[model samples]
Target: MIIVHDRKDVRHEFDVPEGKALMLQLRPKKIGIIGLCNGNAACGTCHVYVEKEWLDRLPDPDEYEAEMLDEVAERRENSRLACQIEYRADLDGLEMTVAHRS
Candidate 1:
């Protein structure tokens, strides 16, 4: 399961399979994630914040994602695009906060 919080403080939880992209998980949940580039890594609209405690559980960002993160507002050490994160069983209870708006 993954927990996500919106700016309004609304939260949602969803089950995700290991090796699946976070973006795919959000889709079925009707979460308003803006993947403007359609997972092509060409836009930063999918930006989100990985909970501090779970930051280390994610793989390092690829060059494309790293470059895009530079353009995200308020980019932080834990910021990442949902498309770039592949779910893993170890991340069963991952928590993140969706960017208010991309």
Candidate 2:
């Protein structure tokens, strides 16, 4: 189960199958997350702030993803493009807050 905290303070919980992209899981829910690049890592529309505790657990963002993160508002140590984040069995119960667009 991945727990998403939207900008409106609403908590959305859903089952994230292993190997699925986080963006794919979110886009259909209409919770305001957008994967503008269709999970190609070309845009920051799916930006999200991972919980501080889980930050270290995720792999470091690649160069392309890092560059994209810079274009988003509220970029932080935990900031990441959701499209680049994949679901894994170890990531069960992962919690993240969707970043608001500027």
**Candidate with the greatest lDDT versus the true structure:** 2
> Compared with the true structure, what per-residue lDDT tens digits does model 1 show for residues 1-102?
889886666888887778778886685565667787878777777788999999888888889999898888888888989988888888888888887664
RMSD values, in order shown: 1.4, 0.8
At residue 79, what lDDT does model 1 achieve? Answer: 92
Instruction: Enumerate residue pairs that collide in model 2.
Output: none
Off by over 4 Å in 1: none
> For candidate 2, lDDT tens digit of each residue in 7-79?
9989999987899889998999988788989998888999999999988779999999988887888888889
Q: State residue 62's C-alpha deviation in candidate 2, in Å.
A: 0.4
